[model samples]
Target: MLYLVGLGLADEKDITLRGLETVKKCSKVYMEAYTSLLSFGLSSTGKSALENLYGKSIIVADREMVEEKADDILSEAQSSDVAFLVVGDSFGATTHTDLVVRAKKLGVDVKVVHNASVMNAIGVCGLQLYRYGETISIPFFTETWRPDSFYEKIRRNRTLGLHTLCLLDIRVKEPSLESLCRGKREYEPPRYMTINTAIEQLLEIEQNRGESAYSEDTTCVGLARVGSEDQVIVAGSMKQLLTIDFGPPLHCLVIVGDVHPVEKEMLEFYTFGKSSNQIS
Candidate 1:
């Protein structure tokens, strides 16, 4: 049996009781690291923390292992129970879904364990989940590759008066372009997009397209280290957020659209200079 377990957000303790039980029983456990992960879950101490709590040692699986070498894991699961752990809910990312499909085709029975993810935990900002439109991911802008494919989606959401959740890019265990050209693999330092950088890139895309989709003064909620005790939630204009510092990794931005009276009132609690709940 193959168990696709969710570790949830935050630290090691976010694992559900069922997920914990499943992990403890599995002969082999793999933690998918390239996607979202618990805060500090990759560091040596963090791994120890999870292993100690789950009562099982976890093998760190990078993007290559999960994508290219998934068969090796499935083959092992064919003989014994194995658990593939994800940071958030098990199926939050499409890659995991693909893995499940392959496991099914390989005759490996699979079970999913659900848990809180950014998709739902984001509601802590007080915005009604039903009011959100299609979520969009913002990739990091490069010198020659500034992709604006997501711009139209954002505009569509704003036109319909729906909130747009912008999931910032996360680069982990990525091969350097120079190294790829050199016919060798060299991983670059991990990068987690900051609210400041995401805002800058969004503004740049708006400038190039000359579309009034969103302005510098557009209200947005900047979130960092979400689902953690020290999570920061600051609501302000994109311009204002660009100035404020949202420390740490796993940051996300929410572009506010037509807001109901209640949402507006709730958002006030995180507004800078108004609410004491501002980021520390």
Candidate 2:
């Protein structure tokens, strides 16, 4: 049996009881480390902490291993119970779905254990989950490549008076372009986009596109280390949030659209200043 388990948002303790049981019963356990991360990250201490609790050694599965060598894991699962752990919900990323599909094609039995992800946890900021439109991911902008395709989606959401949840980019174990061309892989340091950088990039895109989708004065919410004990949530205009230090990674941005009176009242507690106006 192949078990795909979700570790939820924060840390090792976030795993469900059933997920822990599955991990304990599995002969081999692999933790998916590319898409999202826990508060402790993938450090040796963090991995060891989880290993001690689960009573099993975990193999850190990077993108290459998961994408290029998944068959090895599937083969192992064909004869023995194997566990694949994800940071969030099992289906939060498309990659996991593809893995399941491949496993099924190989006649392997697959089971999924669900858990909370940023998609639902973002509602803690007081924005109604039902009012959100299509969620968009904001990738890190490079000097040579700045994609603004998400701008149109945000614009459409705004036109419909629906909120937009912007998931920040997280680049882990990414191979450098220069080394890839040389037939040898050299990975760069991992990068997790901050709320400040995300806002700066959004403003630049708006300026270049000249679209009225959003502006510096637009009401937005900056969230950092969400789901953790020290999580920070600040609601304000994009300009106001730019000056605030979010402190640490795993940040996300919420572009407020049409707001209800109740949501406005709830968001007031997180506004940049007590005297600041409510979300518009």
Best-matching candidate per TM-score: 1
Candidate 1 per-residue C-alpha lDDT over 40-155 given as tens digits, one digit per residue, 9 for 90 to 100 = 67789988998999777889998788889889999999999999989989888899999999999999999998899999999989889999999999999889889999999999
Model 2, CA-based lDDT: 0.90
> Clash number for model 2?
0
In candidate 1, where is summed lDDT lowest over 10 consecutive residues?
A: 271-280
- The models' CA-based lDDT, in order, is 0.90, 0.90
The list of candidate 2 runs beyond 4 A from truth reads 274-280
What is candidate 2's lDDT per residue for 94-211, written digit by digit as tens?
A: 9899999999999999999888898998988899999999999999998799998999999999999999999999998889999899989999898999999999999999999997
How far out, in Å, is residue 216 in model 1?
0.5
TM-score of 1: 0.97
